[model samples]
Target: MSTRGGGPDRRGVRAKVEAQRAAERRAERRRRVLLAAGAVVVVGGIVAVIVVNFPSSSSSSGLGPEGMALQTGPQLASVSSAASGQTVDGISCDSSEQVAYHIHSHLAVYVNGQQHSIPYGVGVVEPVPSTVNGGTFVSASQCYYWLHTHAQDGIIHVESPSQKQYTLGQFFDIWKQPLSTGQVGPASGHVTAYVNGKAFTGDPRTITLQPHEDIQLDVGTPVVPPQSVDWSHAQL
Candidate 1:
């Protein structure tokens, strides 16, 4: 009887040991599963961030109204001013599919083809300084942000293919110039220009332009004299 009772107690102890071992195995598996899941989530989050900031070829940010227009022929530059005594429509910006306004470093703001009141000299965009120093870097997407520091006089200017142009002081009117997509030539994007006090104008200097394109003002010589070829019936 003592041996039989001892046998039953021994069996119970063995069974308890087996149960503990089984429970520990299950706990380990659960820990491993949780770790794997955590790693997957971390990797997935990183991929999502890369997709958001840098879109793949499958994505596009969509073009503005000017960008959507069908371009036909050589491009010319456009200009507008609040004090020019001409309304936005006078510059054909109201119904123009190519109207672009430069307000500071921002472009594509007025792509709606509607003439909006913009403060003159209040906000203007300029080209990178490297371009003026015989650099071939054209202002991207019709607008640009330029960086330059001068101890003495610093001014921004605009010149069109027709040799029409304007000069802007640091605290003066905002200058806007439209670039035509129609023009076909080098120096097409920007006329080689430099900064000077004298305003420039003359015969229609050849410049390359695309439909609905505009370049902001910067300190550079108006390589193209910026004069209107046909002011009476001109679409300048």
Candidate 2:
């Protein structure tokens, strides 16, 4: 009778040990899983940082404003400015769009008195806005941003939904061109500016783009009168 009772007790102890070992195995598996998940999280964060800091494909190639590629030429060289102006939100184009029913603005650039072209493309939109510069003109649902260029009028068509103060400095940024206190494009000299025929007192880059406003930037010698934009019918 004593031997039989001892055998039963010994079997129960063995079962308890087996259960404890199983519990420890489960705990070990969970810890390994947690470690793997933490490693994945760290790797994902690093990738996101790289994408944000690097230039996007569209902007990387100097393409901006109405699908026009920033034309590199003998006189023009790529330059960056420390002055980043207030960016007016870009929007789709509209046939009936206007600065208001009655207000708009213009921009002009001159180097050595001769008018420097404000380039071809400034504020342009397409069906696939991001792929606009990828070539192939997209019309139909085409749009326009606050600052845009049409033809060689040297005008920045600030056709917005309402009347809000815009800046010449912002216009330059949209054009993907360079402008500063004493430099416009490849031309570097004393910079002079005018607003509605009145000489600007402060930095030329900060000139206000009010409705029917005419802004001019002149670099180097020969400061001719800024070509006037006849507001008589100027509605863009």
Candidate 3:
């Protein structure tokens, strides 16, 4: 009788020990799970902060008006002062468009790897009629400047009374914007210019507006390659 009772008591003690060990294992697993979840939350919060502060080029944080992608549509309106028929950089704003020295050049601008639109009617007078073309603004003004743009298609129309040399600096002058080695309009950075898909090492202001010339200016990092426009379908 004594031996049977002792055996039963030992069995009960063993069972209790086993149960205690199982409980301890479960508590350890729960602690591990809690730690892992906390780690994930911390990591997620860090990622969100980085995304908001340093948005990538593909991010919509830097989009232009109407949710337009940077450099893909009209970024700026025609300078208001330009409509006053004031002579800028020796270029004249006449009552009518000149055709004697009519020619076209393309100017593409990029700031921090994002393209910006050169906008229609850059040198045209106010109250200009505009239409949307492929999400871009196209304008036709009765009064015109020697250097004017009819569309936000990056085409610069050089229409003068006579055929003479015109520089990119003169165009910015008409646009009433600052241009230099460290800035392009309102964008400030190290200016890198390209002419006809070739890197230009000289002052961007000195860049001549040749017929059908492809001029590109990049400000800041992640420099984009010069883009070419097909002139076959473009009516100057």
Top candidate on TM-score is 3
Q: Where does candidate 1 stray beyond 4 Å? A: 1-6, 57-211, 214-236
TM-score list, all predictions: 0.32, 0.50, 0.65
lDDT by residue for model 3 (66-153), tens? 2333247437434664545677778877877789988988889988988888876688876355444334443444467788776556
CA shift at 93, candidate 2, in angstroms? 8.8
lDDT of 3 at 225: 93
Ranking by TM-score: 3, 2, 1
Error of 3 at 99 (Å): 0.4
Considering every candidate listed, which one attains the maximal lDDT? 3
TM-score of 2: 0.50
Question: Lowest-lDDT window of 10 residues in candidate 2?
Answer: 77-86
Q: Taking the tens digit of each residue's C-alpha lDDT, what string does model 1 give over 1-236?
A: 24375587788888999999999999999999999999999999999999888766333222211111122222222222312322222221111112132211111111112212222121222322222211122232223212111100111212222332222221122233332221112113322221122232321222222222232222123333321211121122
Task: Predict model 2's lDDT versus the native.
Answer: 0.59
Per-candidate RMSD vs. true structure?
Answer: 16.0, 17.0, 13.2
Off by over 4 Å in 2: 1-102, 126-143, 233-236
